[model samples]
Target chain A: MKKLINKPEDFVRESLAGMAVAHRDLIKVNYEPTFVYRADAPLQGKVAIISGGGSGHEPMHSGFVGQGMLDAACPGEVFTSPTPDQMLAAAQQVDGGAGILYIIKNYSGDLMNFEMAVELAHLEGIRAVNILVDDDVAVKDSLYTQGRRGVGTTVLAEKICGAAADQGYDLHQLADLCRRVNQNGRSMGMALSSCTVPAKGTPTFALANDEIELGIGIHGEPGRNRISLKSGDEITELLAQTIINDTEYRRTVREWSEVKEKWVDLELLNKPLQKGDRLLAFVNSMGGTPIAELYLVYRKLAEICELEGLQIVRNLIGPYITSLDMQGCSITLLKLDDEMLRLWDAPVKTPSLRWGV
Target chain B: MKKLINKPEDFVRESLAGMAVAHRDLIKVNYEPTFVYRADAPLQGKVAIISGGGSGHEPMHSGFVGQGMLDAACPGEVFTSPTPDQMLAAAQQVDGGAGILYIIKNYSGDLMNFEMAVELAHLEGIRAVNILVDDDVAVKDSLYTQGRRGVGTTVLAEKICGAAADQGYDLHQLADLCRRVNQNGRSMGMALSSCTVPAKGTPTFALANDEIELGIGIHGEPGRNRISLKSGDEITELLAQTIINDTEYRRTVREWSEVKEKWVDLELLNKPLQKGDRLLAFVNSMGGTPIAELYLVYRKLAEICELEGLQIVRNLIGPYITSLDMQGCSITLLKLDDEMLRLWDAPVKTPSLRWGV
Candidate 1:
């Protein structure tokens, strides 16, 4: 692997150290139970928003930890889940009097570990709660639980929910806001090349010179199928059409019930994107893809949205969520209401994503 | 090359088209003689700042064309320099009644094309001037290039001078500011892997698994030497030491003499970086390198600066300047005076480099 790492074991720790030094004003890194917390976290009576998952998908969990976004982010080893201790430490570190909200992506390892973290935080009297994000339309069913994997919507949800939390939303209200954002968002991704995990020392998958993977997961997971190479416009239409045509999708996601004081299974249905829907279009690069190519994807996506009568009210185009050095792009269409629109446009100051400071 | 492009020939134009579509609120693209200019450009009596070069440097000259940075940017084909017409058209489009300042990097093709454009703009009776940025300390002598190649300092100069223009610096004043920035800055780069031009189906150079290219230039140029791969700290010191230790670099650069109406040679010398020097440290990724790895480089860089008694007062870390998908990074150190520091802190809002809204 032609990577700039000294050793696989030291990669994550050293990366976190490096991040701490580079953005010390914006964040402070806790090494032992690795978690990145805002430089001025534990705001007196504010709700703390926390998110955690595997590494590799950079500028996601960790880079987002700052003033207007995540209060703390727990990072695991590359493509591996963060241990519960890490999350517990994060919850303790950023717990303001109001409470904490865990934004957990729907991955087997992530869900289970965060579940334990929730329990541990409860034992510590931290009043921590969580909402599951499962917005990927690539997977057809939740039976395999390699269930609909969360992708680009996690980023959108982080920004919107973090903004809501900043604007005086309590733990319950912020959790509800996060759940709404997740339910209203859908994402589809594709890969032109697979990324190599530092530990594995090779690419996760191989593609022929003329092949491309459609509906790829962030961690180099195999997509629905490999198909012949296509134009940028064609690829955009394929992913956008799948997302646009997807009917209401129902899944059972567990959420912390504030009144019941226990985890409860809530059947959630993602409403179909109907005509005249105001949407926020996000075109994300899979690490290796450049911004110029992402604009191409947005060009075609804007055209498709116009044809399908979906009004794109706002847009973000860049490599916000990435799969380490993977060459591809993902498209996320979140049907936005006035409240969500305001939150999305709210000022955010983070290492990777920033605006309206 | 496994890129998300429809056809190799259509790469530059299509990418510009995509940029226009995505950033329509901020900028507009001029086709035929391709250039990207600010949507609200020629800001009534503001001295316009125009910069351009080869494509593949993702956000360098193109993504930086926005409100407070660049008035217009001309993108050439992949690694080739843009023609004189592109610059002339851009100058005309953005000439508000004040004048124009062209920020040209020190490359043969870019210098020549911009020189021609300067002459053409002068003929058109628009006061045009330029500042050549040649801060790359890698090249040993001008026997081939007057000594060093222009690298990271071009971006720094653009940003500082862009801010100066915004504050009503005339064409000559902005040009002088850009030249001072270029003079104060020094840079060195290394590559873990070579970048492939979209038109060229292979990497510009090859390296073994345990090898690296040191003192490399941005355009896939062969570096001063190749050596066995080392830890991130070792690599960082190797580059930082070069820029920090470089003293009294003398080179002859040609500048357009308005009174003489001809390109004239001027001997330029880069003064040394001394102890107690307050500076702006920029660690830029060459496209494919991720932010996590860059933090590792910065970690070592911060230590060396502390040890050397150099105070880094401001910093920028990311892939602002790039070479397609090259896996490597470059470090730039610009000794900052009070004026330069104030200009650097001035607000800039662009697709790539932005802060201080």
Candidate 2:
């Protein structure tokens, strides 16, 4: 394992400075030993959207803070959440009269730090809303932990919610939309190789060349199971089936009639989808999966949907969100209604995710 | 080298199927032996933008198609150009009443196939224009070969030109803009480790743990020289200085009066740049260089720009474009005028590059 760096400790700070200089018009750095927002941000009105996480996922929280998506992003050390103080400063800088929305992923450290920032913001009388994205289906739904971890779905949520916010949807509406995307979407990933964190300077995990870990987390966490490499068609079927089974898309349709019969007053229960409800699918490369391979997965997924008579309204296939450089991909499905489709089609201009102007 | 695939022959076809399934709305496979575009394309009257290249560079041609960027993308096998037939089919399918613009990255196979597609489209009476992107500074300019194989600058050409097309620029104007971006921008790359193309299943080049290859191409092509790995700061300086020296930015400014006198008929030549001109900078990952590392490179670039008194108006940092999984990054700088800045600020909505909506 080889790298180009002066010292491990100087990586994040030096990198941020470089970004500020390179994208002077789009971004600026505060340079006080904290990851702060640039003074110039897009759109002075509406609520400000702020997100931050580890540093390895470039263009994620930081690269995404431009015209359409996040107003400010505080990148922490590689794979480590930013300190609450850093978040507080970002919130202070970007927060206008319209308040702020904190788009947080559900990692333990991320949640805790963002929560502390929210509390601190509240103390300052600056209104804030927190939307925790827990879209990964790899983790089991449990009482002990906070459901599943957030992975690729964060990108979609940020773009969608960013569009809504840019369109003058109040902070509450933006937060609700963010939560809705997180709730409606689910992602499951596998890893053929573990990524080497720059500081560590070696592979994070070792595996035989032929084996792949399924249901892998972004931080190189162990997946649910290890399986031998398979055909693209076979892998697509496995991942798609897992996502469909884990999601409420299929099960909820069947339960719709039963719930309607049990309760007439439940308005939501009566709107049962009678097959052919449209969906938005995303096949994301974890980190190291080639775009070609991701597209291949998308092709097979489309075949499955066609066979099953599901109407895929829209589809996104690429490395929208990623682990460091995990050599695998994840499948994400967002069962869309007409409203979600309209929102999805709305124009967004961010450093990362953008679609439909 | 580890990868997830059953066999090499089935890679491209299987991947195409997966893309169609995952993004059924945005894309659909023709399902004939050849990959074709979805029937519902180019909504109507919107100028079609098409691009294609080798497959390994995921998101290059395919991931970029959507509303604002490419209308259709034809990806070939790993690191191989798509056949002429495929490009012709893609051109026909994506073309609207507004004619088509083919954005060709300056690789031998890419250039040839795209040229053939242009001829085929012309034979069909569909208007077509070609904008060749040749921005890499590593390769010397020559009339015998397409001067300097287009590298990281293709992303800027696609994006800036995409924004122009999205704004309803005529095909000729779009072609000119793409050409201008390619002319104004210059990039040079360095790699730490050679990437393993999925089809090859082996490292493209062998390098010891401490070695680095400079002036590398996106497809794991051999670089100019191999040397001991240096500090990130030193690497950044080496690459940036190389690009700066290769570009005609300062020399053009110095020879502005002479060039203007000689080429008075040319509008662009008549309007030579002054000292206060702004620039757009990009530090792109080869494939595997993390965002953190890329940003570190950007810092050194900023120092150089400051010393040279260059006003960087906008900076894009990250792996917007990439090699398969090459562990390296490249830096790009685009000198900007007011018009270029406005165009850069224009809104774009593509699957890959999106900003200023």
Q: TM-score winner among the candidates? A: 1
A244-344: candidate 2 lDDT, tens digit per residue: 76633221100111213221121111122225757787887766666666666777778787777777788776655666766788887777766677767
Prediction 2 TM-score vs. true: 0.80
Tell how far residue A197 is off in model 1, in angstroms. Answer: 1.5
TM-score of every model versus the real structure: 0.98, 0.80
iRMSD for every model? 1.6, 2.9
Write down the lDDT that model 1 would get.
0.88
Best by DockQ: 1
Residue B87 in candidate 1, Cα distance off native in Å: 0.9
Residue A179 CA error for candidate 1 (Å)?
Answer: 0.6
TM-score of chain A of each: 0.99, 0.87
Candidates' DockQ values?
Answer: 0.64, 0.43
The C-alpha stretches of model 1 lying farther than 4 A from their native spots are B258-262
